[model samples]
Target: MKKGLLLIYLVLCQVYVYAQEDAWVYLTDKDNTGFSISNPPQFLTQQAIDRKNSQGIAIDNRDLPVNETYISQLKNQAGITVMAKSKWFNAVHVRGIQEDIDALATLEFVDYIDFANSSLNRSASNSNRQDKFEIEESLIDFEYGGTQNQVEMINLDNLHLSDYTGNEIIIAVLDAGFPNVNTMSSFQRLRNNNDLLGGYDFVDRTDNVYEFAGSNHGTKVLSVMAGFVQDQYVGTAPDASYYLFRTEDVGSENPVEESYWVEAAERADSLGVHIINSSLGYTVYDNPNYSYTPSQMNGQVAFISKGATIASEKGILVVNSAGNSGNNSWQIVGAPADASKVFSIGGVDASGAYSSFSSQGSATQSTLKPDVVARASSTFVIDQFDVIVNNNGTSFSSPIMAGAMACLKQALPSVSNEQLKQFTRMSASQYTTPDFMMGYGIPDMQMALNLALSVQEETFGELKIFPNPVKNELHIQLPSDTDTTLMIYDVLGKLVLKKSFNSTYQKINTSSMISGMYILRIESSSGSKTFKLIKS
Candidate 1:
């Protein structure tokens, strides 16, 4: 009797373990093309759930179970269990194994799957972005162009970095490693500011990956976000904080690299990575057969893309590069790039013309892609020695925007990631009429900031501009008592006019300016202010 009872207990324990694997916390891959926050895909089978879990290596917490009807419907599918159903949305976390991944990919309702991976601190980045204008004329960086654009750097000089920095808005940059950052002069301020949160090393499965500098990619990405510079390559948001995860190893673009990214995303979420900017893309790899076909662009085919979307739904922001495909035939968005929910950035020249290298759209039946464009060609960045290097790619664009979003999030810490994305689309150059070419168009940081502030209060400021459509002679007033500076910019973010209006009351004239939308910025001894002006 004792032997029989023991056997029964052992059998029951095995069943429980299998049951645990059968259920998982379901999350949408907001960055995945066919799946994610902005575009969600349907769950397929149990096999699909297991596959995604194997990729993510993270738990989807199966505290809840799927409804009876839903379970009955999914009975035919392999590796699938209705772990739980969301009362609000179709999104639900499920469980299964690798076979489920294949099954779900074939299902019409399935979008993508993220499996569990154990690697950590792995990140990817959009490395090449241009802060300098890309017009046909000689491009001037923020420094030299300040005079021509009429933007007074001095006006924005006093804005305290921390006042606009948010602790919760952290991004984990996955790349080779950053050994020189602590000693590098360009990144010293970031280190001193303690801008870096703790990180992990997935390659060795050890914590000692930070000791040596390996790939320049991660370092460059960090420089674009946190590198402190006044005249040199100023990151999109210099004061913003970040955490660096070393997931990529030197020299090899391993097939397992995707697994590493999954690990990084999990760690990033645990450590509260507000955003993820990975410049890497996948199509070809060490395993040629493992390479993806255009048909696999559905989002579930690639492990990393699946994980990218999973991260986004967890409230972590994810940005990916559309790929440098302008020069290639497979010019469409890559794996994770094909994932729907994530923001895939494209590259534009200093002339504002789209670059030939920027990857195209999500390939699985033409979905929205390159959600936005930023300066990527011949863009300036800090290299190994803090020297400015003009490189190009959607890789750099992602980080610059990530940094800017960080500042925006800092300005309004309460704004959910969903709302931020919505604002970005609505305030974009092509919000209402989005195209596959540019998801919404480039984002204007100033306008975005102004709008975010406006939503928070009855009025962001008591300031106003008159002669609303004045072709010239623009007028302005503010309620601040401190000394002030005035600046006017064109719709292109180029400063066309500027003056000092330190007095509490002052009249300004822009009668000589051309007709178009303009921005009037007010800068008190305190930071700065922005206004939307129209010249007709």
Candidate 2:
């Protein structure tokens, strides 16, 4: 009889363990009755406030912290364990049995409860979740060594020569783990200059981001931008400051990881981070019921994607990997990468070809994704063990582009994040003809800088160009009534049309031109002006 009771008890224990689940308890209001947007310093740092003010981004309720009173009340509830909280979404992630999680909805402050396991929820929504080191020939001034090809492929070398090496820019790296970043020899420069700011481990709920026992993916990713060894290996943006964040739990895949990411992003925003390089992407979860469908890659659907969009709206440039599902059956870019505001980076080979493993964009989405490609195939990085090695995946490509963008940001401090994205896309090799595999293709940083400068130095009087995506006739309005020379060039830099116009308003016949992107340059006595034209 004792043995029978023991068996029954063991069975009950197993059931209880299996019954435990994760969920998000959303609060109805923040209860910030006395908070004011004008006084942003209460919650935001001075640097963060300055960044918003410079960008003309107004401070709003989203900047307000979640109500601590509501959180404390939820903590007092039995069987409810608060895991993570997000101010942006006004939600708190918790773990408990189905009944315990559901009971939270009865509270006055509780808005609703969204379970990680969709089957357990009453709502309709479902949520979810390297190689060797070597040294090569140096071509530019910086001793890039093995990383020369990856940097030069995107033309970031030119920016380095001009001393736009991401000085004063703070970047937040959200990934799995960053082991040995403090002890690595390549990161000594960052330590000496205090560019390795600080970090937090959202997964472990601790301040030590480098002590996680998970995979060292974050460490490798950081080396692509922050690693610097004299004449051996130079990262893309060696002078940039960084805040390492561990958000991913390598042991298990769950929606709570997404909550962890949102929390880290909020922290980065409060600390005034300029760029966020997230080499992580989410689609499937350990619980199949919490898995996301490809149709949900619409950017607005996923929780993490929404947080990323908010980060972008907060004046932070969010760069994410396009994912490595290209060769798999589920061949599409993952969420957060699918977010329209994110600069989703794809991977390409050294020969300027798209990497087969780099995830592609879906055809159903109206917006073009995998915004740009970078040299991620066999990309070089510094390992946690302090060895120079080559690795593959869009994971490395995102940082390559992020570091280049930091350099561009340093060069054009006044340029907004949206304009910087546009300039980079316009500078891509395949901007005229983007596809699912290589949307806008690889960016040329030198060309991007030139485009930005051209727009900034438009000293010529206001010129109006209408019907930009012209199907037949193209209209051009000159600033002054003077003889203006108009020239149009194809993506290959070949002059296609050249004509002289005397009238203030001129109409050019473009009915016979092919459908693609063209550069229209107008030269006159006032000044020369350039415009990008699309012929539909």
After superposition, candidate 2 runs with Cα above 4 Å error: 1-18, 32-34, 124-144, 456-502, 507-536
| lDDT (Cα) of model 1 | 0.58
Window of ten residues with lowest summed lDDT in model 1: 147-156
CA-RMSD of model 2: 4.9
* Residue 401 lDDT in candidate 1: 66
Q: Which stretches of model 1 miss by more than 4 angstroms? A: 1-168, 210-214, 363-367, 453-536
TM per candidate comes to: 0.58, 0.87
C-alpha lDDT score of every prediction, in listed order: 0.58, 0.86
Residues 280-309, model 2: lDDT tens digits: 888887566677788889898788999999
Candidate 2 contains a number of clashing pairs equal to: 6
Model 1 per-residue lDDT at 532: 67
Error of 1 at 406 (Å): 0.5
